[model samples]
Every structure is written in C-alpha cells, then in structure tokens.
Target: MMRKFFLVVTTWLTVSTLFLGSMVMADTYWIDVREADEFATGHHPEAVNIPYESIGERIGEVTGEKHADIRVYCRSGKRSGVAKATLESLGFTQVINEGGVEDVLSKIAAEK
Candidate 1:
C-alpha cells in the first residue's frame, strides 16, 4: 500500500508540473491606448498604457526588442487604428488593433 500511494503521488505531481509550465509559457501582451484615467478604471492584463497622442514618443519604450505581438486598444477603434499604423511604421511587425478597450477586455475575459 505504501509503495502504490507513493507512485500515484509522484505521477500526479509530474502531470501537474507539466500543465503549470505550459500555462506560464503562453502569456500574451497588449497595449492600452486609453488615457491614464480610463486605463485605471479597467484594462487588459499587464497592458502598457501609452496614449495615442504620445505613442510616437513612447514607441521605443513600448516595443523594446520589436519582437512582441502587440495588440493596441483605446476608447474606440479610431485611435487604436492610428496607433497600429504608427507602430507598423516604426517597424513593429505584429500589431493587432483591438478596436475598443471595453470590447477587447470583454473578449479576453470571456476567453478565460
């Protein structure tokens, strides 16, 4: 009985470790273009807040290595679209316009 219990516990631990490792490796990043106040109200998880107007100045800071798949968001699609264009021009290869902050936030929450 003791040997069987030890084997079962070891098997459970190995499977749980694999699942936790996969989850930690699959995180994604998005950019929230809402003003500071709006961002404070609610925003995507760990999203970088760089308002549209100041995006150009903050490009390097946001896209340090230029290798991230960045999704941009704002109050509405208009600002995020513009931000997407600017990001593309700055050589960010993967910029997704998330339309509106509320919409994007809802989608992400539902996915989880």
Candidate 2:
C-alpha cells in the first residue's frame, strides 16, 4: 500500500511539473501590415495597424519589446512577409507572417 501511494505521488508531481511548464505566459502582438485605407476597411480586433512600407521607420511605435511574439498580416501575404523579414532584421525574435487578412481572421476565430 505504501509503495502504491508513493508511485501515485511521484506521477502526480511529474504531471504537475509538466502542466506548470506549459502554462508559462508569453505576450502576443497582432499587427496588420497593410495601408491605412485597407486597415480602415477591416482588421482583427486584437491587431494594430502598421504598414509594411513604414515598418522600418515606425517599428518602435508598433512594438517596444524585441522578444515579443509579433503576428503580422496584410491584404496579401506579400506585405506580411516583408514585414516579418524586416522585424527579424531589426532583432525581433518571434515575428510570424500570418498571411492575409482573411486567413488571419479565420485563424483567430478558430482559436476562440
């Protein structure tokens, strides 16, 4: 009986440790790398507008933390790809090109 109880306790501790490790909070930034006109039409609720062309110049205004998980999207995948590259060049650690507006919106909706 004592051996069984020890085994159960050990298993519980291992599972608890794994669960806690997986629960680490990482900040996420959703960005719309589209022009103002396109952004004005529609955008993800959690996304901030920062045009691809202006990314280099206005990156500070968009995100201060270089290590933050930045998710970017645009009208098409082209601009977001550029934005992702630019952010990476600027020392951003986790820049994700989440594709076009529709694709991103669908992804976000599915996550809910």
Task: Pick the lDDT winner.
Answer: 2
lDDT of each: 0.83, 0.87
Against the true structure, whose TM-score is highest? 2
**What's the lDDT for candidate 2?**
0.87
Q: Across residues 1-112, which tens digit of lDDT does each residue of candidate 1 receive? A: 9999999999999999999977754545678887899899999887989998888789777555455678899988899999989888887777889899889879978999
For 1-112, candidate 2 gives per-residue lDDT tens digits of: 9999999999999999888765642667888989999999989998888889988888887667777788999988999999999989989988999899999878778999
Q: Estimated TM-score per prediction? A: 0.69, 0.73
The alpha-carbon lDDT assigned to residue 40 of candidate 2 equals 94
Cα TM-score of candidate 2: 0.73
Worst 10 residues of 2 by lDDT: 19-28
